[model samples]
Structure formats: structure tokens, C-alpha cells
Target: AQSVTQPDIHITVSEGASLELRCNYSYGATPYLFWYVQSPGQGLQLLLKYFSGDTLVQGIKGFEAEFKRSQSSFNLRKPSVHWSDAAEYFCAVGYLSYNTDKLIFGTGTRLQVFP
Candidate 1:
């Protein structure tokens, strides 16, 4: 069985500060990993994905993540977060064996920015 879990329900960070969001998954084999961001009442936009190759992947909006196979974790990180970066982050796993390219998403992590 494949599943994803985000331990942090919500997080608050000051503008221009570094940020980190946790993500953990359970899967039988190596799965395609992705991180998406969604603003209030908006659709999700792909930040980045790790299919193979590099363990650390860079993403848009000054974000990056490192995939740790041993730990079963893919944690997102940002050197300096902007106020506009405040949104809901979801970690997802894509199963190629499935009929459709559907993603199994984590509960979600809400990011709050303080000016």
C-alpha cells in the first residue's frame, strides 16, 4: 500500500526566514514524488518532482527539496520565504501502475507568514 502523511497541520514563519515542511510516505517501491502549492480557493501548482536521478530537486519560487530513500522522507525547504509564499503545501506520490496518473496526497501543511 502507498500512503503519504504530513505531521505538521500548520506552520507559521516570519517573512524572509527559512522554512521547512515535513513529508513522509509508505510505498512498496520507489514512487514519483511531487510537491504542490495551493493558495486559498485556488488550484494546486506543481513546485517540483523527483522521478529519478538527483536526490535534491530545485523548484520554482525559490524552493527546494531533498529525497531521502532510507528515511522514506522528502522534505521541502526554502532559504527565504516571502509573504506571498503563504499557502497550503501538499506532498504527493504518483503511481505509474495505476490506470490514471492520479496522485496520493498528504493531509496538507498550511503555511502562515508574519510580517
Candidate 2:
């Protein structure tokens, strides 16, 4: 089974400060990892994804993540935080079976930005 873990349940940061959200995944083989953000009462939007390519992948909204195979981790990072970035972020691992891909998401990390 594929699973994702977001150790931080919530994080608070000041605006203009750096932010890092942690994500770890477990899978038998090379897993498809993704980061998504959801604003209040909104649907999830894909931030980035990792399938097969370079370890580092760039994403929208000034976000990026590094896929560390050895550590089984995919951590999201932003050099500076913004008030608009406050949202619930989720990390997911995808598995394919019977020609269907299912995403297993982590609990999620809620980001709060302060002035």
C-alpha cells in the first residue's frame, strides 16, 4: 500500500518569512508523489508532481520540492511566505492498479500566515 505522512498538523509563519512543509511517503516501488493546496471551501489544486525525472521539480506559486529516494521524503519549500499562501497543503502518493490510479493523501498541513 502507498501512504503519505505530513508530520506537521499546522504551521504558523510570518509573512515574508521562509516556509517548509514536510512530507514523507511509503511505497513498494517508485511512487508518484504530489503536492496540492486547498483554500477555504475550495477544491484541491495541484502544486507539483514527481513521476520520473530530475529529483528537484518546480511548481506554481513559488513552490518546489525535492524527491529524496533514500529518505523516502518529498518536502515542499518556499523561500518566502505570503498571506495568500495560507491554506491546507496535502501530500499524496499514487499507485496504479487495474489501469486505474488511486491517490493516497496525507492528513494535510494547514498553513497560517501572520503580519
Candidate 3:
């Protein structure tokens, strides 16, 4: 079994400051990592995902993440934060088994951007 951990439950940053959300996973093999963002009362939106190939992958909404095998981390980073970017961010680990796909999600980190 694998799990995702988002150590930070809440984070506050200046509107124009840089942002980084930590995400760690526990898995024996290389598993898929995903970052999703959800606005208030909205559905989850895919930020980015890492399956294989490049360790660093780009995503929508000016977000990107680098899969660090050594650290077992796939952290999301944005050079600058905007007030509209404030939302609940979730880190998930997913894989296919027995022709079925499963995803394990973290508790999520609520982002607060101050102007």
C-alpha cells in the first residue's frame, strides 16, 4: 500500500511571492504523482502529473513539479503566487492494478495568498 503526505495543512504567502507545496509519497516502486487544485466549491483541476520520463514536468496554471526519486517527493512550485491561486491543493499517488486504476490522496493543503 502507498500513501501521500502533505506536511503543511495551511500556507500563507504574499500575492506576488513564490510558492512551493511539499508532497511526499511512500511506495516501493515508481508510482504516478499528481497535483490537483480546487477552488471553493469547485471540482478538482489537474495541475500536473508525473508518470515517467522527465523528472520535471510542466502543468497548467503556471505550475510545475519535479519528481525526486531520492527524496520520494514530487513538490509543486510556482514562481509567483496570485490572489486567485488561493485554493485547496491535493497531492495524489495513483497506479493501475488488475485493469483498475486507483488513487491515494493527501489531506490537502489550503493556500492563502495575501495582497
lDDT of 3 by residue, 1-115 (tens): 7999999999999998999999999988888999999999999999999999999999998999999999999999999999999999999999988899889999999999999
Candidate 3, residue 57: the lDDT equals: 97
Q: Which consecutive 10 residues in model 3 have the weakest lDDT in total?
A: 24-33
TM-score of each candidate structure, all chains considered together? 0.97, 0.97, 0.98
Instruction: Return whichever of 1 and 3 wins on TM-score.
Output: 3
lDDT of 1 by residue, 18-67 (tens): 99999999988888999999999999999999999999999999999999
Runs of candidate 3 with Cα error greater than 4 angstroms are: none
> Local distance difference test, per candidate?
0.96, 0.96, 0.96
* Candidate numbers, best lDDT first, in rank order: 2, 3, 1
Candidate 1 weakest ten by summed lDDT: 94-103
Q: Cα lDDT for residue 85, model 2?
A: 99
